[model samples]
Target: MSGLTNNTPRPIDIRLHQASRLLEIKFDNNMECQLSCEFLRVYSPSAEVKGHGPGQEVLQVGKEDVNITAIEPVGNYAVKLTFSDGHNTGLYSWDYLYDLGRDYEALWLEYLGRLSAAGIKRKES
Candidate 1:
């Protein structure tokens, strides 16, 4: 996917609910989403999770209890998420975050399917 464009919707508010382990984000487009920390960690757009090329994605397991320890801004375009597991590489752009929110259900289902196919059971949180 391409980076942010001039028309990209930026987040107007971002709140991290530590107790619930959810990141609630509202965009300028009037769209709001509450993404689980585990979801964000598993779908991280980093080389360690997404890999460096197509078909090289490393399936992220054992992250059912993962949480975001920090949300550091990366200039005006993205935020660097620091996971409790020490993963801090993915630079999540506004476009990508919006997409992740919009496509949450489908993406989550796909991840579950991949795990099932690989016979990897997620640890109960």
Candidate 2:
């Protein structure tokens, strides 16, 4: 909901498991989360994905097989994710990442619901 603060949690470890297409992140606060590439790709904060404002988000389809091609740090506050589809614009800040990790289940379910409502399907790999 808000930007990172002085007491915000920071990642202590980040591992990309290419075979599984999951990025495992462990924070200094001892919280750990394994987020799938599809999840990250669909929820990307880039303007291309999220658009310019609320209610402008582009519905991403056929990204179930996307993978993380690279992970680059953005100063000390965020990490830039390079996806297999050549999209690398989102700068995932610590707070954002944490929220993604924390709210993954609900968010994913919501995505699925939206997909179903739109008559779209996640293309299986």
**lDDT by residue (tens digit), candidate 1, 17-109:** 988999999999999999999999999999999888999999998888888999998899889999999999999999999999999999999
Model 2 C-alpha lDDT versus the unseen true structure? 0.94
> How would you encode candidate 2's per-residue C-alpha lDDT over 29-76 as one tens digit per residue?
999999999999999999998999999999898899999999999999
- Which residue segments of model 1 deviate by more than 4 Å? none
| Poorest stretch of ten by lDDT in candidate 2 | 1-10
Provide backbone clash counts, one per model: 0, 0
- Candidate 2 stretches greater than 4 Å from native: none
TM-score versus the correct structure, for each prediction = 0.96, 0.97
Report the error of model 1 at residue 106, Å: 0.2
